[model samples]
Target: MLDHVQIADAIAESLITNGVRTGTRLPTQKELGESYGAPRHSIRKALDLLEKRGVLGARQGSGTYVLGQLVDYQISSRTSYNHNVRRLDASPTIEFLELRTRQATPEIARGLGINRSARIFDLYVLRRSNGEPLCLARHYLSEDRFPTLSEHLEVATGISDLLRRIGMQDVRRSNSSISARMPAKHEAALLEIPQASPVLVLEGRNVDAKGVPVEISTSVWPASRIKVHV
Candidate 1:
């Protein structure tokens, strides 16, 4: 006799074999119970476990839905999301989540080579591929270098394009650091993965021709879907 946990694993396997994908609703508790020869309560428990593992999600007043695997992302000093998406023949889009002016923290100052408490422009962006969320990025730009940055840049404009348009040509990535950890509650919600899912973090700096740091970026991607290439 299979336990609720075992039943849940079996259901997950069934989902893949049946071609069920992200956003595909699973059968109702009663139906699952009947199919698996288990009690309704056990079926619910199975679903709950799956949800905690980020394999499924239960929406209010809606049925539980399958949560698909994370999208793969490649990280490198020369990483260009636009180019990568084009190479993969996937539609890529960027969504601006927030923009604000704030004083830089010591860490941000170090990354951008600015003084602590210096004014900076913060831009939060969500990058998607084929309508699926992929990564969340936070950008810090030195206000002194591009005072009118917020007014000139749009959500659709790539960072490289923005630099060229603003007369900051020849900008290149100066440094990047990578790390990994489980996602936080809010981050998990934004990425539509379970809270226990791991995320890859990349911290990078971009410099102009003079080698002066102009921008600092920190992005988090789903670890399950992305691999860091050097």
Candidate 2:
């Protein structure tokens, strides 16, 4: 016997096992229903569940399809644009506009999981997705962890890969705190959106497989362009 959610999980499993890329047209609802021994409504319910997870898409006249592009994610557990985009072989370029060593103020300390006055790497970046401006981000990393961040500025493209080179394999295990608000003037300018556009702000630390904070990231994105798939 199988529950509906399990059935949906099976569909997800099948999609992965079959190499279904994003944008693959899914089986029609009738086809799915017949194959699963379920009714169309039940099949639709499963598909809807997948849609909300940023895994599927619906079109007005074209039925349902696979959502190929990875969504900006915020599960209660973890999320990162770097890990998200890799599902499609896309990579984010980090402009690395600034990287400085600074004394951690109270706010910075809390954000970086460090004691007050500790030295930290303050990093500013522009994150681009497929060559379009996606976010403006700031990162704070305690100097004890990322030792040479201050002396170098070579990271004009991609942080996750760079981290892997530095021996951090799992960039997705990071703790994330997220919120949404209307864009501030500065944020609007940086992100190139209208002042009225809502922006989602994400702040968190990228934890290594050992659960250490490897990268601290803050990101902002216009509401109209993103869907939270958690």
Candidate 3:
């Protein structure tokens, strides 16, 4: 089943069932090979074809994972990141930095499926593992859906946490794109990295349990330290 097509389909189905949306990361090719009894090279070919079909992606050191946002009732895996980190001898903290209203930019609007000038709810979150910055997230919400967005500031930091808080019980990501690029001067300063350092950029849009686009988020990670698992 590790051939070009079979393994790819297997991964796709597995992801779909697990609620691993697009732009989510998958297991490493080596892990896939081990799991499926294929050579790494063959596993890589399967991944290559999946990526071509917009179903898989590799994020530098983060290993291979899903490629785009989440799809339908594909219930995401019931994994608790906070618990996992604590089990790994670390703590998790979600800092409720702040939220505001802003007009979406041309790029933001396009991803959010809105007019380029639509106003949206903007959120800033700092996710720390063991009290060290692990992921910095900026989320954009279709304000029309959650007019009371600002009132939900004290919720957890993880994306799933926020989704649950909004009563979006079945929210799932349908597409996401993860890329790495040199950090901007400001981002570099904030992440405590050199300007030349590259940061991992993740773009994700999630649909509600009803499959309506309700949230879009772009997260930045300092490439040197983060281990991204989609």
User: Which window of ten consecutive residues has the lowest lDDT sum in model 3?
Assistant: 69-78
Per-residue lDDT of model 2, residues 1-230, tens digit only: 45567667778767755545556788898998888888877888888777654467799998888763324444544555666656546666667777788898887777556789689877788876566566788877788877865444574246655666556666664556779998778877776666765677877667766666676777887654455555
lDDT-sorted candidate list, best first: 1, 2, 3
Candidate 1 lDDT, 17-88, residue by residue in tens: 454546778889999988999998889999988877677889999999877543334556566777765555
Off by over 4 Å in 1: 1-72
Task: Please list the residue runs of candidate 2 whose C-alpha ends up more than 4 Å from where it truly belongs after superposition.
Answer: 1-80, 86-91
Q: What does candidate 2 score on TM? A: 0.60
**Residue-level lDDT for 124 in candidate 3:** 82
Superior candidate under lDDT, 1 versus 2: 1
**Comparing 2 and 3 by lDDT, which wins?**
2
Superposed Cα deviation of residue 96, candidate 2 (Å): 1.4
lDDT of each: 0.78, 0.68, 0.67
Cα lDDT over the full model 1: 0.78
